[model samples]
Target chain A: MKKFSAVLLVLAFSAAALFADGLSLADQGVFSAGGIVIQNDGVFDPVNGQYSTYGQLLHADHANIFYQIPENSNGHSMVLLHGYGQSRMGWMGTPDGRDGWNDYFLRKGYSTYLVDQPRRGEAGQTSVASAISTEPQELAWFTQFRMGRWPLFNMNSQFPQDEESIDQFFRQMTPDTGNIDFDVIKDAMIEVFDKSGPGILVTHSQGGFPGWTTAAASDNVEAVIAIEPGGVPFPEDKLPEPVDAGYYSVGGIPMSDEDFDALIEKPIIIIYGDYIPEDSDLPAERFWRAGLEMAYEFEDLVNSMGGDCTVIYLPDIGIRGNSHFMFQEKNNMEIADVIYSWLDDRELC
Target chain B: MKKFSAVLLVLAFSAAALFADGLSLADQGVFSAGGIVIQNDGVFDPVNGQYSTYGQLLHADHANIFYQIPENSNGHSMVLLHGYGQSRMGWMGTPDGRDGWNDYFLRKGYSTYLVDQPRRGEAGQTSVASAISTEPQELAWFTQFRMGRWPLFNMNSQFPQDEESIDQFFRQMTPDTGNIDFDVIKDAMIEVFDKSGPGILVTHSQGGFPGWTTAAASDNVEAVIAIEPGGVPFPEDKLPEPVDAGYYSVGGIPMSDEDFDALIEKPIIIIYGDYIPEDSDLPAERFWRAGLEMAYEFEDLVNSMGGDCTVIYLPDIGIRGNSHFMFQEKNNMEIADVIYSWLDDRELC
Candidate 1:
């Protein structure tokens, strides 16, 4: 069978080469977080087209990871976790058809494992079910993502503003099949890191919390690159007061000293895009400001605790016009380079 | 933006060409079944991360499709839909690591659009929720799929029976987020055809029902190639008596004459794998026999109604050792060739 696979692999690649003119990959496949079995004692009723789960195994609550290893691999994989109402697609390509962060990094010789977190996207099977809110929330997310007010763009916004682009963007927002559970998410992600071995961990939006937890819990997350993370981590003993952002508090997750120290032991970077006003009457802007405030506190705390942490406010760094999804904006490659440079500096690339 | 995209396209292709030795796709991207808008009347509260649905659009019940257009593609694409508890992954590759039907058809100069049916796989968002059953049913499915009974294999079974292969095979099984609704599925599929233009429809197992309905409802389906369809379609007025198979009835769906006629308008072919016993006390085998029996009836009914239909019993045609998922077995290419020949004869490829 192994020999058969080798022949087929060669034939497959050769056939691909024959076609020519697109991405060449050394390997690409998928894996899951694993599952459990349910032994049933039901009987088969053939007369009604009914059968028992009698000897069948039901696999559930597992995360799905789709990975691609480019030719001449770097041997270091980047595990990408997406934010709320989002999936691995967000990192695969931009709504406007531009190459996303995945391609950019792939070109730079890094393997990418794009994750569909448990209860979301391809990893939709869950132990607990949730009513998928079909409530219109695209506009809300647009504002929250800092793309701009409805049907309007922040001045010089890096997001592609064409109608098709916006439509595609909204279509990419997926609902969770189950209520979000941090522990469930972290466990699955740790398994991913375990399978992929030690590599960089990159999280965006809602994934940040679990990314941190997973990174701290597993030895496989060598470094962390967070893009507009929804929140940061704080020491449990010295938790900061929640910052009032009008509707929501901007308090980060409290963690044990051991977990905190383990997290800080590795290099960490938090990135914030443009359009997050320092102070605003607008709720979206105001909430983001509070979130940023917490990030600053996180940075100070991590560094003070002998951890390496860097916060890059895109505007302050003179790379402006980014919305919350900087890695998916028109200037996505530029933003990716910042991440690449950071990894390079640490010899972790 | 168009020019920018063009430039990126050229650069991306060239970059791919430089690497060589793997799949060279002219274009590959994702599109979704269109969704709805929820006009929410609400307010945003910044202090507690609370926001209203005002101006937000909620998209629901849309199917997700990932497509790859090979270089110098044949205009007639193949839209691949999966079976019960399975996703598009089944058609992409085998659990034992081998190229799947998609690659075979692609190499034959056909584009492939793999579908994750509404509320399943990547299309997990649904209007209604269902509890995910995480029972141990791998052995049951193994038997049901005719790969073999648990801890056993049918004589000369073509299934990859290695432990890892078995594990991966079971892991690929996914649960539906909601109850199965053929109308909803057909609706989403019709949209896929609408987007991709007229194409050949290929379906496996449970997908076969919706495949027929979608083809009936839309002119976009030029032909259909069904691999072990779960059941055939029957005329509503002349619905056949349900066949007693011990545990389940093997009666096909009843459709309006117009819909039935519309479905039969396209050339159709049904292929069943080996090991279906003419008489069996074993529920799985008995049930499959009944399913095959219906296929024969469906063939006669369609042909009698002045429509084209054919059934291929693999063993009768000198092919053997195939389980239900013949396309994912070692001889997947051979089975795909059978499909290609059918489409080619119809000039649909």
Candidate 2:
């Protein structure tokens, strides 16, 4: 009882001190940079002073960055990249109204740059227009995300099961204003790093593919922490047979040896969550299982080439009950600590 | 020099104290509510356990609110609605990296809820599809927003003239994933008020029309502070002739007498920025001038009905050099102070 009381007092003091001397919302800075502005060729109407649609500047294809630097800073920034169908809101906080990785890392002294990638979320403007589909995707995504079959959740899932939480989770799924063009994504992401300075790339799911490419393209990405990256990249010489995971094939992208070598220059960590089976009837699990297999292969390839890589299977480390979205799970802080420890070991924190 | 030094010292101490005890970003809460979920009627594939496209849930037509409540909150929330083509980012800060109305109101002991209307910004999902136009609107909007003609800005404009600031400003414009349906927006705004409880609606340009209707529909909206409202609401019996303002019309919405009566129950203030000429060849200025004229007519209607309504031409009060987006200008804090004073007079702060 006394120990519990002491812990409470310590927590209270820490909260008070954090409120007093650390970063407040008012102290943070928010802005955007990167992406090319395409100027259309149109003349202005002399009589009305209105530029024709062709003459206007199209400010499309940029990453919108919302960042905060704490007073007691570690001097390193964590550039958070969201997954497919998600935005910077995913990294900001959880659907359950709890502190997300944004707050956790800030409290731990690292600045955060939550990004809304090109043609998605706040960066919805695009050079090429795509039809924004209104097809119902909530259930399809919920099942595909490996949370559980529709109307039933994984028994041990850490996702908040309240109605409101589910509503919020569904609401967070955004449509692409433009097609998911890899080249567009890469250019915008590279610009984000160019402007934000050197930072660690923290990517989730689909963002991992571009994250790898951006890291190879930009010297600013110091390291990468991929949370269930869709797939890693393989050098042309070492292409593995694509795994036929239903709905989509689990195949690593083929890359040039030069790009592979550039990627190997940075230390990397790949994290996979629970409920993924070695072999299962479920396509979601099958998909991740194949991706996990690629992760080990990539890890081995990197280490053989005098590069460092770590692949962590959460259950192996006694951290379980996490779906694909481990960062938003109930034990999110516990998972954040694991990444912190990895960063510490690499002397990057 | 001594007075200047004293002022600096006082400012320094205030910053320190604010850092110590006031609301930090971590202290704020963010979540979304009030969207209808459409369940598709399709069967799941028994073989793969995948739901058909028709079987998933479509979560659409909602307001996305990012809110902050300070430790010294005034107990009343101020709901901020952005202008056309913009999002909640407009109220959060300036493109030049200065505090916006969100920070100012938070500091003044009022909680703020920055909203992204249905089919806009954070709330991008919708029931109906709208073509996200890629037509360069930057220059056209620049002229239409009264920020001076493109390639040439007003000499005394408060807008940040730096290239980076202009880039940032252009990047802030977002596309509507769905069509701009007022009914959809009204429903979503009502949901926001329902969830956030009673509060004042602080609206800009395009948001003002919906703001008035929403206030009438939802009893929770205590008051309204409209900045350069595109148009006011007029009773059907007293409808003004629609003004022709070139590219579009500047006409107040026709409302039922009961709706108008309901609106008059709440204290309202209308603010118009500078650069609006009473007679101008510029369509943008002409649009606003006609709207300004309607504001007085609406004010007279409200006042005659024993309701409170104040319309202020910014230049009339010596607050000049403001374009349409006064909230994001260099003197944003000064404008915020004017708003605070008004709220104080109404016993709202």
Candidate 3:
């Protein structure tokens, strides 16, 4: 039987090699983050299946937004907001790494949108490269040595210091650059909901902060599925002290516990990594603990605000050795599943 | 407080719009399956920090094997296989969808290999356009006319004839076009293990079939993690005749029950999706029964093979709906946790 199986295996391989004419590993090489270019093609109209307008959102920093129409016209849409320094492609499925939450919801019948957040990806208004090169002696000392070794503490090294820096960095990063106004996302989402009806918002890592803010601002947002939302900026008392150099602390955004409580009123599901300590050497960890804490605090806040909330703490299976980019880890599908189930249970979809 | 909260919400949006550069929804568009391509410039080494001679594997059929230097120098190197018809992208994290399992393992200090399986994605010999146009008329007729209106089965119209057709159909419908060829996936996995030491084979959906087969064929595979595996290929006597196209049947493969028994000897954690019926239009009754039966058959098969098999029947989260692709659905992270917890409990990782 073993021998026969061996022959069968060889035969199968030969057959596969032959019959699989169009298939190749080269195909895998084609689907990269950089290769995925999003083209804006009109608003989604349930009444008609025609897409009229087409263009790409070249963020002021030149980042791209990769979005897709849902497979079903279930009158609901979803926006996938990726974390800091990640591109819109971060939401696309990965071959060997973590696939954020796109596939899970796609399977669940939601028109999904993925965007490379501001100051990240190709659209980055800040250039980590230039920042490292152009720092003052005091800042430059930290930029060169401290930045490389301890990225979490070196904020100036990570993002632009001011509006001028933002412009300089983005101009340096990509030639085709335009600022993606947040209103565009909001307006598009509103249009989708107006046509498809109310929808849900799913966000991961730093993306969660903006997602929550979006939901808080819009009655059209039915629910928010946040995977490790960073920094509960309400009820100042409960909020963590801002990490000196992290992006979460930028723009003098208050991290007060009171602010966190007042910012959200939508049903939220928070999924956190169980295994990894919140304070890893990775720069992203600076906000990881804040995200987890916000998830907890927000749960209470939402309930108090007459909204629903649920939290699922995942096992540290891949967390202990990973960074705050847990959404991009191996066990992410499990995380996706948990979120899917929660949405389903709540009928948020 | 409600009015005050509303005012705060408005301020939050205004602040975000003023401070953060947002993503433009108008410019974001979907890249249909196989429309995007990835370029591999062998820069990052999965093993040591330095780049090595190993280039990306572009299979003859256009599938891909993105080989990273093993992160774990002394630990096992494993293949991170995605489900059918999905590309390596399925492993990356998405905000609103399922999270990939790749990130979990990689972060856990495991050396990983990601491949797009053959006949799916860019590696797919059959293109969606071709699959749709060239489907056997009879099968197409059956699906279009007789099969229920459920989208899950509706996509099955493109499946080729045979026991593996269901697997093939699901793969065809998945968005990632570059799929991992079973033989290439196995070979790459073996190579990684050889370089990085022993490791387990982690697989989801159709990927499970190859993982099981690979472990059974070689002594190098230390363990197996099968998440909602399809195509179990059970014994003829154990299953009903005709067997329906979606369920396992004695088809192209010549492996006998005994052969299956002889092949697998490693510890395996089989995670089954607990699906619940919701809509009346869904074939909930049939699906639930079939899913359970298949799960039972798989548990029995692995245990009979003298392998340490742990079967986890996940809680019926009404949200997974009635779809067979539960692993790819939202809120399924609990399933991932179960797998990880089982591994940790057994000290397998």
Candidate 4:
């Protein structure tokens, strides 16, 4: 016990330094010489005048960090997008200090570009008065990802059990104090695609929109792997009498089909986890289950339009018990293997 | 967008059935009737002459539910305990509707008893003025479980993106307005053993203490599977020059060597995830890393005392990317495979 306390005492003092500024990417040892560069795709709002305290409104812009090819590069250049309450680090670490997807893929020879959406992470901040929605609370993850029952978790949950892991995961989750303009994020994504060159578009959760939006707008996009794409397009249970007036968009706000062409050449697969409609009475579970059904509707529409889209429910492929964060789950490597297998099938990787 | 809206409209109405008081065990088809019952093993406080609201403190009480075996059961019985803010359901179902640990074990022929510590879950409630801490907020899960950076998340994070999942996980999480009465939980566990006969003990997170506490208090526990047991004992970086008075414990309180004997006959294994110092340099991550070190110290101590205690780091075993919640992860079955393998090795199953 004395020994333990001593270690604690020592760490207590050392912690100030360790946490002072956090460990930046300089030590990540990920990029080769002349392979790393940081740029911004957004512009300062300046609407309120350059001198206004709120004038900078960092709202209209975003920042991108590009990790260039390493010595034995595989020529696989991909853009990595984070999910809600997360930044690039979400793609870098597993909370327990394991290799995040960015490094995993980078090691595999991929030139990875991680993006920070406008007003998120390093992009800058915004105000609730000028945004689309209020900063979200710590509630959405519980149900959408299927970690456990809402309000109450299934002790058998696949989510992490370590308190520090849990605490860390949440600690880095910077709340959106202001609303995010999806269009800005989409534009930033397009900018990333333009700067990074067409490659595989890897997106998780909310990044799904920006990924799809970017891919839809760029012919350069080679393939799209939408990991549980947010706001997926699903056919209505009943077709409207007339399909002319409204636009159906995967991204929020109605988008017309005429606005974008079906992704014919791009091999797209939307992957979701195993348990949906968990055998519980929670409405959240049911809603999620129903939402997932849309992936099928989307597949049919794409296929009808002569586009390439495949919807994969991990369970059907023998991968079960996956929560939304399967990418970072214990079997992440296995899942990556599965994804890589798909890439191989499509000859993308 | 029209199609999405149409589908949304239909689902909005049909969702009623989909979410109606989710289908539980009666329809779960996993167990037989007369198979489950609840019992308490501690006393309630009569602080106000047995009539005040605080009079029913029940600070020293814990509740346990016992699931009897079915005719086709494997004839194995086990006591299942949950982590912080969790109860029986934590072991029963995935938020997305997959089988929980309870069903998984029961199907494996192990009758299970899910515990609700005093003032937690179905165990009952307590007054904040009398407890150890405040009720948790909706934000805790964001980091604690490695779902993503708290408040904000990775657009690429696999944590559920939908609002329902988030809301559901929290709704069930009853904060500890008061402190957990570990002694009560331990007593309850002992009673479970008395009523159910000698069996294995499967504990997660906060339940770790009770599992250990109970084991220390009784010889009925045949084996122990401490899943990410919190407050694990750690080996001192260097033993103090003078081994003075003090104790090392997983929980905050100090424990003494004279208090318990080495779990000589009962084989025990503590399971931890892949990342400790998750790549992100968050203090929370460091804290978790420190905690995991304790597991090694614990294993060393138990083994030194002629006890069979092993520390299984999943990553070392080729299981990677797992957060704290391995038992409920996507590869849960695979993890279970490993655990079962150990059990088989010990001839416990």
Clashes of each: 42, 1, 114, 85
Better of 2 and 3 by TM-score: 2
Off by over 4 Å in 3: A1-349, B1-59, B67-74, B95-99, B119-197, B234-242, B245-259, B276-288, B316-332
Q: Per-residue lDDT tens digits of candidate 2, residues A194-234?
A: 65678889999999989899889989889999999989999
Query: Which segments of model 1 are wrong by more than 4 Å?
Result: A1-21, A38-56, A151-153, A303-307, A347-349, B1-21, B40-50, B53-56, B131-140, B151-153, B234-239, B256-262, B303-308, B344-349
Candidate 4 C-alpha lDDT tens digits along B1-349 = 0001111211121111111212111111010001111112233222111221221111212352424343344545688888886645556444333445664565465656655554443233222223222212223343555554544443333334454333323323433323677765676667666645678888887788777767766677888899888765322332212221112222232444543353445888888875565433543445456566666766777788788888888878887766666665456667777877888898777
- lDDT (10s digit) by residue, model 2, range B228-282: 8878998898988888975778777999999899999999999988987888878
Per-residue lDDT value at B21 in model 4:
19
**DockQ of candidate 1 compared with the true complex:** 0.19
Name model 2 segments beyond 4 Å from true: A1-26, A49-51, B1-26, B46-51
- lDDT values of the candidates? 0.76, 0.79, 0.41, 0.51
Q: Give the best candidate by DockQ.
A: 2
Q: Write the per-residue lDDT of candidate 4 for residues A248-347, one digit (tens) a residue.
A: 2222223446433634457888888766754435444554455466667667767887888888888788877777777766566677777778887887
Query: Mind giving the per-residue lDDT tens digits that candidate 3 earns over A170-244?
Result: 111111112334443343333323333367876765565556556655666787777666544455444444444
Q: In model 4, where do residues sit more than 4 Å from their true spots?
A: A1-60, A66-68, A127-140, A150-157, A234-254, A259-264, A278-280, B1-349
Return whichever of 3 and 4 wins on lDDT. Answer: 4
lDDT of 3 by residue, B1-349 (tens): 0001111211222100110111111011111111111223333222232122222211122223333332232255566667643445555432222233544454454655565553333233221212111111222222222232322343322212232222212222232222345665554344333433467777776677666666666666778877666545455455533333222242222346664665555677766554323322323233334544565666676577566677665554232321344333344354566666777776776
Give per-residue CA lDDT, model 1, range A1-349, as digits (tens). 0001111211121111122246556656566764333344554332232245443345556678777777757879899999998888888777776677887777777888889887787776655667656455566677788876666788999898766566567767777877888887887788777767779999998899899999999898999999888888888877889888755688878998889989899999999999887787677788889888888989998888788899999989899999988888889989998999999999886
Cα lDDT tens digits for candidate 1, B1-349: 0001111211121111111246556656676664333345554332233356444455556677877776657788888999988888788767666777877787677878889887787776655666666445466677778876556788899898766566567767777877778777887788777767778899999999999999899898989999999899898877788888755788979898899989999999999999998997678888889999889989998999899999999999888999988988988888888888888888876
